[model samples]
Target: MTLKHLIGLVRALTVFVLMVGLASAANAVEKNYTVQSPDGVTIAVQEGGNPDGRPIVFIHGLLGSRLNWEEQTSSPQLQQYRLITYDLRGHGQSGKPDEVEAYRDGRRWADDLAVVLKASDAKKPVVVGWSLGGVVLSNYLAAYGDAMIGGIVYVDGVIELNAALIAPHPEVYAGLASDDLKTHLDAVRTFIALCFQTQPDPAIFERLLSNAAMASWVMTKTVPSMTVAVADSLPKTKVPVLLLYGGKDNLVMTGPSIARAQELNPSLQSKIYPDSGHAPFLEEAPRFNQDLSDFRNSIQARK
Candidate 1:
């Protein structure tokens, strides 16, 4: 090669190397934080990635922690987004405060989220909630619906949690009403098996058990109230919503539930992973990440 061409090549390679180095440096510094709720529950959170990128917050279900969304937080598609995930007040690394009243409604839970966002100085974030996490998100939007939030992604969750709870179907109702964690889990597994058309995984069951055993009195209060509230007001969430469900979800009756949810809010957009059940993020991480990325891009593009 001519000396001129070689010099040009060196400069181009140097620029590429610098860009990669900057990205690597940015990826290395994932920060973790803790925020105290109004009721004194210290919730754990982790924040990192492009500080100027769109903020995306993930909320887990009844018996889960921020750890459940670890894949989303670390995803390359999410690298350009400021990702945040946290444990509910009584679950995961968060403080388990006793008393059902503390968890009765999603108001305090919303406050907890607001505090965390403010503490981190994050912009209006697009919140992705799963199962009970979706309940909390709906409640947050219902009570504090505003432009502060860019969008909502209900991952196997909905605006009317209580409606799902009260839906007629002796078998499903019987399954949801069980107070025994073991029995509830069996029902969950059975439901999963039915929906997925396959045997349920023992590892998933064990994780559910671990999450259940840690539940506080507060977590229990969240169930009935959240159920009723959503039943009463499922159609009001007008924010951009994406309902992603697992066709194999055992606890949630997919067809009827999604149909009813869409009926309540005509603006609701949805997608279902046929081969997966309740935990799509865990069961199909790559596809889940891609779908989420595409959704986020669409949201960003609109603005």
Candidate 2:
């Protein structure tokens, strides 16, 4: 071939490759950052979907991280809204402070959430808190009130550490606090299994178990006694609140937990996933996502 023709052909191929790269970049919709909490813990944050759309912040349960919301984060049906999730102070890639105060203080957890919210620049975002995350939300309400949030969703949330609202699993709890690696690992397995009444796909469960294993051992031992101000917080929240529970939850008591929350806020709304357990967001994601979208829209309509 002539040199000129060879050069032209190579240029054309280069242009084609550049176009493909641009197309791939356009298809990617997620970004990540780290936020420093007031007490200096580094919290990892991730954002996905439409950047300018209304925001929905998801707070995962105990021993979980941003990985817990993959179902919601990757959904095409719910991609219209901006989705934000983060690793709690002691879990996943976030900083794991050795001090008991960092893990056991409700205000510290609340501060971590506050830093994430500020970092996201989410305006009145719908906050979805699951399990231990619900306790963080209650603490946030107690510390900061409802002025910054659009709505709240508590999914099989822990309102308090009260035995009346928590299903008894004494051996499991003690095992979790045990210093022996075998005992703690077994307890983590048992606790995770209890989160799902219908077993998740084996691969999904494995990934979640790995996530749990990454958590700080000190955090697990200290967090059970973490103070929660639900009694003072939920009743005083002016924003719309939702209680989304798994009817068959093996961890938190569904009816009693809901009743306790409702007693505090008479206007609280609730829904139950009859066949699911602690992790309804994972067990029944499509329905949970739809319910979440509808709840956010309802809140917007009222504003």
Candidate 3:
């Protein structure tokens, strides 16, 4: 009832409220939604982390969905930032168009990304594209330019599908495109295995396998022949670009990929994980998260 006692209680209550708010933000569950791409295909999008914090949009590779970014979405180091992820058109919970034409143009993939950004109302977020997701980034740049985005991180990205950059995997590609369920499933397993120098955790691999299985067969058959605009688009990107490659990658030739990318955009910055294979983000997640945070911080500092 005394003045000093009432002041002390108020101070304690304020501290308690602040702590609760922080906890809630840290524990916020990822929110999922579906946004229609320009062509009317529904793309499944997920958002988490501090809603008010700087945003980072994660684009997964072929046969992957938002689920591929679990290493990033659940990262404690990145909790201070907004995390956004989505499934590519024919993958995961997104609508899968049976028409081969739907997956042929690279620009449609780019437009899908734009749709996700518009739907989320993200303000110039940094985009991280992995593996096949790199194709999406190039198309996006060709279509939208860099004015709408702050920066980008290319994680073990596929710069060009040319022989010099893409490792020889005729057997795998052939099997994947096959209509035989047994052969297709076997190829999927082989392809995922080739993603890492060391094997992934059994549980994680299983989860990824399940996601890959859910992908549309039509996409697998059509996307290989899709046009890549990296040569045209990458040369024109004005935003900060970071390239992360795994030296031991079997799916993509790391050295050649980086060289081709840098040749296209001389402003690109890069890092290599000698021990990792195709998926450095998962093989070295702790390091990847810190590096990403640092990249975001550097961009913020410049602004």
Candidate 4:
């Protein structure tokens, strides 16, 4: 290989080493807080990184919590931003309200985020959502519109959830029913395997799956409405959107979904990790982090 090629290889290795080191040190850093929603449900949240930086709120998918984005919250990328990851109403450490109304649409989720942002005194943050977290961020934009956020990053998020349009299946329900966290982790691994089309770090898969098992039971019950409501409102949103997908993602990261998302918001910027699947953030952390940083920088440049 030429010297130029060698230099590029060295840079890549340096980034990889830096990321691995950050991952190793991440587990020990943790903080917990709670935010009360409009309806009185107290949402659970976890935070890390530079508290003085620009606020970047993270929302996890169905059966996920702030822990889902643990690595991202811990990484050096966060040095430029204050990271906020939260458990939606019935998931993770958040209050699990029994009524479906409590979880319906993305309004309450957005409200919970607003409460958290207000508490943090982080104005107009860049909201990042994974899975249903994407829907929540979009709905936040829909309700409060662009006035509430600087930008949005959707990490293998549900661009829209209409089964009739996207084809839902029993695996979705089966995934939610996994009582053993290990089994849930396995299922997510299987799911990720199908989506990533490439090998992923087995340990990250395990950690996320464990979080899924702990936070997911309630998602099965509420997903139907979350899908319908978010779909109905997506097309009207005009805020800047960044969409990232795992090429191997079997759930919602398909071509049609990407196309539909773009159609809904013509300005939506998208990136695909050909080797990744549903959980791109974990499955391909380094690439995902770089892409996210680039997207954020691009937005900053525009401003």
Candidate 5:
């Protein structure tokens, strides 16, 4: 072939390769959808990663939305798994019913999760819950059982919230109940600070403060009563459980909680991030992601 013709062919091949790469990148982009709960509340859902891969649903804590899982969703380690996140009712973009009864009923939380799972078409998926989300997950298992879930991961979550268990964190309840906006915000800020062993990024701290400020007061007041004895459910759970906690977590007493969980379910596996606090997933993303990936792989192997 002539030299000019060879050069032209090479250019064409490069253009074709570039176009394909761009197309693949576009295809990998995450997709968002709106899922409606049985009670008519709308949940904003985001799905990404391998479409046909094992589903992993992440439920964020009180005053937290699907955005809380940005690190996990964007991590290359989880790109091979189907990742799902959604705003819990009364948080984020989801509808907030003004009635106290809405947030007080534990069934509502479970039902909302059921709808999200059904909408996502997640079959026997691995469910990960953080903080209040842990309570929600327990409520779900109580109401729906483990038929639809293959595994559970609790990240600095509450297993029980009886007066004794909650007594140590008066600041948390005080922050939630404060009538003065400044008092409430300040308390919330303190609570956030307590969640980390080290100071968080300024932007992240600001964002968390903003999100906490948006939480409905009624929901805050009602959540304490909504919790059931999740430890009771452990005896019946046959699925693998990974309890991830922050050793420095002043919010949730990790030792007692983990001890109680292991006592109830001997098969339960756990790991503590000694350098981290309440939100270990955020405080130690690399290690947390690796643990999550390992947990996911173990579950997949059993399946």
Candidate 6:
């Protein structure tokens, strides 16, 4: 072969090898593992991004699984941070104990998180919670405190659930209580649609509905009574907190809750997406991902 042809061949082979290595790295991030909670429940977990990067743990809402954070996980900006997501007990592929006692009280929820952190070997990671996941994080703080986490992120979540604190969404809660499966599914469908400000992508919407339908109705009904108000716990939290919410959210009122959280903990910071609904992370993913990256950086800078 001519010298010029040989040089070109070498360059092409080098490029191909680089591309293969990159693809393998990306595939590595998609691996899934299982961790056993203290209560013996098996939690399904997925980890991705830079192995040496700052750890960020994601907790999904009620009836939602680790799949709920797919957008964030796939974001290029977040690729530099180690991301961990787990299917909470009673949802997704995680263990579902048929007994009401398993769902009652937030101790199991808190303990599940601890087990996931330990199993993943993540230390002082930032914990991000959405919807009911937010409540679960609050329950974690109430039970275990913030010593194990670098920061906390609340995405349209409530620290306290009381009639006097916020208006009731009878229709939303009623859907969970419905006896008929069809009636319950229909209510859940409406509730899911209301969660988005603009029409969601068809595939994502369907996947969300499918996942939501998988949750045990009995466990769903028991969660409210099981979760105690974390209002008092907020004042004691020492880690920095970032609260992200949608201005048009119809499910949980963000203004009062944000104000109350800020009142309780001055270390809290927030961003409101005016045009979005309950799921700001999914609705405005690019912006949400950037905000989260910035928050993580700020926390690291402080250290």
TM-score winner among the candidates?
3
Compare the candidates by lDDT and give the number of the best one.
Answer: 2
> Model 4, 81-168: lDDT tens per residue?
6677778877777887767777765677778877887776766677788877877776776666576677788887776666633435
lDDT of every model, 2 decimals: 0.71, 0.92, 0.91, 0.70, 0.84, 0.85
lDDT of 1 by residue, 1-303 (tens): 999999999999999999999876676477887988878889898876677788888998866777668678777677888888888888878888666666775677777777776787766678898877877776666556646777888887744554553324456335544777666656554434443334436875566556655656346444556432454435666557888988877656667767877877778888999988767887788899998888877888887
Candidate 5 Cα misplacement greater than 4 A, ranges: 1-20, 163-167, 229-232
Order of models, best lDDT first:
2, 3, 6, 5, 1, 4
Which tens-of-lDDT digit does each residue in 1-303 have in candidate 2? 999999999999999999987754454468899999988999999999778778999999899988999999888767778899999989999999999989888999999889889988999999999999999999999999999999999999999989999999999999988999999999999999999999999999999999999999899999989999998899899999999999999999999999999999999999999999999889999999999999989999999
Residues 1-303, candidate 5, lDDT per residue (tens digit)? 999999999999999999988865564578898887788878788888777778899999987788788889888788878888988888888888888888888878898999999988997888999988888888898888899898999998888775544427786678778788887777788877887888779998888877777778778778887857475577889999999999988788888888877887889999999989889889999999999988988988987
Superposed by TM-score, candidate 1 places the C-alpha of residue 221 at a distance from the truth, in angstroms, of: 7.0
| Per-candidate count of clashing residue pairs (backbone under 3 Å) | 2, 0, 0, 5, 0, 0
Residue 122 displacement (Å), model 3: 0.9
Give the worst 10-residue stretch by lDDT in candidate 3. 22-31
TM-scores, in order shown?
A: 0.78, 0.91, 0.93, 0.78, 0.91, 0.92
Q: What's the distance in Å from true for residue 301, model 6?
A: 1.0
Ten residues in a row with the worst lDDT in model 1? Answer: 191-200
Which of the two candidates, 2 or 3, achieves a greater TM-score against the reference?
3
**Stretches of model 2 off by over 4 angstroms after superposition:** 1-28
Q: In terms of TM-score, how similar is model 3 to the real structure?
A: 0.93
Between candidates 1 and 5, the TM-score winner: 5
Between prediction 3 and prediction 5, the one with superior TM-score is: 3
